[model samples]
Target chain A: MSDRLSISVRDLFIDYEIFEDRRAAIRKRLVQHEGTGRRLVRALKGVSFDVFEGEAVGIIGSNGSGKSTLMAAIAGLLPLTSGDVLVSDEPKLLGVGATLMPAANGYTNIRIGLLALGVSSNEVDMMMPQIAEFTGLGEALDRPFKTYSSGMRARLHFAIATSVHPKILLIDEALAVGDQAFKKQSRGRIDSLLGEAGTLLFVSHSLEQVSSMCSRVLWVEQGRLRADGPSDRVIAKYEAFVG
Target chain B: MVTSPEPSSGLTSVSEALSTREYLTAMWKRREFTIEVPLEQLRSTHQTTLLGNVWHLGNPLLFVAVYYLIFGVIFEVNRGVDHFLLWLTMGIFAFQLTSKTVMGGANSITSNTGMIRAIKFPRALLPISVVISQLLSFGIEMGVLGAMAILAGVGVSRRWLLLPFVLIVHTALNLGGAFIAARLNDTFKDVQQIIPFIFRLLMYLSGVMFPLERLLSSLGEKSWLVPLAELNPLARIIDLYRWVFLGASLTGGHIAVTTAIPFLVLWFGFRFFKAAEWRYGRA
Candidate 1:
């Protein structure tokens, strides 16, 4: 209900009810004993956070600590099972970074990726040059995406995903996949975007990245918010916890 | 374990919340969606090759010959069954949608884990794109089957108009299977292994290469499979194809189930896919 905030969550939760086997599920009504008393796995539990316009936040957590889930929920990919996730702008969570239809080439993937992202054709065409440049994948851009190296795929994905310029940019471990050179360039590019007042939520294991890029830090664990404050305070706690 | 109380104001109820139709209408005007034209680019990128676009035709034709040679000529089932290619082709073509929908569609979510994790477009579009792309492949195969049907003295009839309608049902069935597969594939990689085998069993049961008459005569039509054989969901689709193109009846029993069951299956498939629509994006 807070329209001023870019993203506001009040006790957001995501719990999945894993059903029985398909055959058992089909025969469930007819059969008396189909097995019961199993508890659901809660992936995200009563978690809450807020991101306003011009806020660049970094989320850190141990593996399986729900960093990705929190990002996905904010991006609207995952619906909250309980509570609320209110967003004032569109959110883009970088997935597969850059996806290529193995059968298709890089240029092809760019269009489809944009479309898959639900971009307008005119907008995709407009951003094509900028996307191609950011990838730095020159001559290889004409080749099939499958033929490109992982670095190239990541580069291509990062470029196309960032092409339209997202409002709520939620990047999950993007820098972790790229090479040092690409990572260096990625940081600069991201910082420039942040300067332009874009709200970002970056989830990464890299402490240096958390401290350098984000204004605030959010430490997540077991699908709950563990700590939220200044970058130094949270990263120190997270690093300590990991150690 | 802490339980979430039910949402206030009965938001879970279908009528209380924004209906899908209403939301879609609102979206068209406001949302500036980017359509991923992966297909056009994917096809164009590979256009320079020798087989060029012919490879699309060549692959399915090769499959048709392989199936016909193995199941038809070598096995002598061609002589045994009437309209051998027609029947065999029907099964392959009909099941192509199912196989692709089940096999390809199931992995749609798991395969696009990166996309699922990143963006907030319709998750349904991922499976839909798969089915549509596969449908393009099926179109090529169907053309081959249609040509063969023409050569066998079966010309196009008015019934062919229903092809689009049947195709819609076929799409619905694939979409439903895709929804289930997209979610199920997340935990079980084994689903991928068993899909081809399921298609093979269904092919034989649905009277694809072998005729339903043979199954009926040998197994006795009234046996447990009577419903399956008589109603034969797949066989009906093929019959509809043959009846429209080849201008032949695939038996009255075949037509009965084809006309009735597809609609039922389609309805449920629609409901099933929609119910799990949001879950797909998350998975």
Candidate 2:
């Protein structure tokens, strides 16, 4: 909520190496060269931005525009090719494909997911009831996660991810699958994260949701920050550009 | 109107390698995660099996039995070694432990690719946890080894107490091997396919089924292959276990080689593993 910087991404660049074939990828390891078959796809190019504490910033971009890559970079999940990403705290990323064991039941996943996210075992037990209620899978929680419908899976993931009240939350389109009731509940959770003065970086294609929920917006174009300003201004510019 | 943002003083840039202190501290904090996952997996491993946890005991027993038939009954490969059954049992168990630990560790990171990308925990925990799980299974196999030792007319002696000491050294060696395999497999993936073949060759060279000293003496003491065989840490571990359990006397030189090799491997493997910490998930 204060003016302190939550995240500072300075001249950040991420290069994804594309191997034309499996042999090329394996051979590159032995030879230590790009070889003719190896190509570097720069996912984020000289991108720089600063997010203040308690600010909810929506990163809007078309597919392959580096929205998820930027979020992953900020979460310290991706390897940066050049430049720096400085964060006040380790950001919790709630991607739709967040790490849940498909083979395990929902209850087991809740324990493991929370544990993976660094929640203490004792706290995991205490948080179980609330997480169970929020996800509302009920008896279905006993079945394997792979058996759950995609919507059910997303809901469970969202509930477990929000259970810890992260200091900085990075959500990459995890909310897109939920129904109206689930959305209402998640909206409340987001508001609570905001109430606790937590910083939020959301990557979503839903312009209406982004415009309403975020105070500021960032428009990424082909790995570059094309626009950054108040939500209305940036969204207007983005719409005009697209149209 | 928007103004250009200031470069904040709080910015802390990330480098390729985390400091040793920071990395260790982070690992220590998530120590429970490392410990719990393996325990959970072991519990669920045979939950649906009719024999349940008995398979942990049964599987190794069955494996050792087949090797016992081939090497003990048919080939009489245990001819020179006293208490052949006990000797063969120890060798197979130790060999199995090493192979399992290496193979399991090799797959640890690559197998959990999704989790690594989804969560940002210490990457080292993957291999560390693999070693721990294998150690747990090894503990159970040791009990079966003890039963087999007694059945073969070997009694408990002061030398048996030395089993724990050997175990500690052997564990260090396994941990080191696991670390190396984990890193190698993350990159080459061919490392996994090649591991079984490599271990198969090692099994013969390391004297897992037969007495190396008997073969070495037959080939002449001064033979270069003798020292080469002595250099293998797994052979030394197997010989060390046989010495403690079956009362075989390994030469002073052989004992020295066994003791020295594990520590050396541990020192080298750990540094080699740590140096590649940042590359595990990314690669």
Candidate 3:
């Protein structure tokens, strides 16, 4: 694939407030006091990165290190306190326990998922069988989603998320849930997705997997980018630091 | 890969949110999601009940029946309004639609945090879908009200054609209200609890169960309450419905104000809600 920038996140900042008590928050506001009952956690602090087309990049970070928040901000799921995210197209976020209708069967959830991704109704019809096949749920595809095991649910989510072939895809530790066979199938699907010049930002805890699959690795430390380089070089540093 | 052009220099102007036109176009494209998700939600909402979908119609009917018992049967507070049943129906149904839409819209964002973070779609669709869901329920309730009106000596007339126009204006107002409510509720959790009480007070002021004209005549035309009661879009829309459905007297000034207020509120509400589109998910 040619080297064209597909995703650029510049000086991004995201913070979330924890409201410990509902009444306290209300009282604090009414009393005209600032920071009396709320705590602001800065999840991402002026982080910046760039991804080119067809690049498979893994984001590695310690817990509370803002890996997921960075992915979410790129997808426009989180509000930015400052900075900018320039993208060629909307980024699809693939995460575990996505809110597909639980009462609806797997097949219906597939249809809903496709439509939510802005797939046309006719396209949804054309894509349903393909997704259902990939999910490999067979007869269980007709059963309610709540009836599925966690592994099955993850498989279905991965299948539906990949069905649209988004130009930019963000996977947030979703692959960590499924079994070995499903994981193998998902890796194959992601490979094909990247083969089409799509950009991928994968957040995972597995260093070995990141070292193997990713061409580049970004190590995020306390809401900032500590290192960005070749996978082997950065993962080694990350491992040494953690160990 | 060879070194690429500096991304920061080339993409520095990229704002955090989509442009207004771009956002609306994208939302229009994914309009199907707005309908499909909410319809499925509405359908599954009552599956556990023995009565199921019947509760949609039954709940509104039960509510109207309680009001009727108090004002119609017990106190006989008809207040010379012809076809009191139909008047009450129009007022209650119209008022209820807006109230429910506003409250439902308020909860839309908070209830769907998982969906918001999982998929990429215009967050506005959530509030829009809530309005649609409530409108669907209102449509069915209107059908039952129509049947009841027919049996109560109210005849269909050419004025009935204006009902569509009334509904269009009412929906615009509801859409705008939903947008504002959705954003406020996301910022302040206390707003959700306070909304129902606010709507209850609106129900009394909007003349949902009683006639505003009676109150006006007693309070005097020059009283400050006259304009307050007359200018409220809910009251005006309910009055427009009464004018068409029950042949009640409605002034041209009232019609003009009712129609104009909805569009104005719609424009303001859409802009107000759009300004905060980026903030819906972070909290």
TM-score of chain A of each: 0.88, 0.93, 0.95
Which run of 10 residues does model 3 chain A get worst, by summed lDDT?
A: A1-10
Model 2, docking class:
acceptable
Stretches > 4 Å off in candidate 1: A1-3, A12-46, A61-65, A79-81, A95-103, A144-154, A176-197, A204-212, A221-227, A231-243, B1-19, B22-55, B66-91, B149-189, B254-257, B278-283
Q: Candidate 3, residues B1-283: lDDT per residue as tens digits?
A: 2233565533433345578898899898889888887788788889889999988888887888899999888878786878887788788889989999999989988888777778877788888998889988988887877787788878777998988999999999999899889889998888999999999988887888887766677898789877877788888888888888888887434768777998998888889888877677556
* Residue B266 alpha-carbon offset, candidate 1, angstroms: 2.3
Clashing pairs for model 2 are: none
What is the CA-based DockQ of model 3? 0.52
Docking quality tier of model 3 = medium
lDDT of 3 at A216: 97
For each candidate, what's the DockQ? 0.26, 0.49, 0.52
Tell me the tens digit of each residue's lDDT in model 1 across B1-283: 1223333422232112236675454334223322233255337534778877777667656777899999887888777556777766776777776886678777777777655555555555666666666777777777777788778876666777878987875666666676567656655667888878978877777766766677778987568887776676676666666566656555667465465666676556555555655666332
Off by over 4 Å in 3: A17-38, A146-148, B1-16, B220-223, B251-253
Off by over 4 Å in 2: A22-36, B1-8, B14-16, B47-52, B218-224
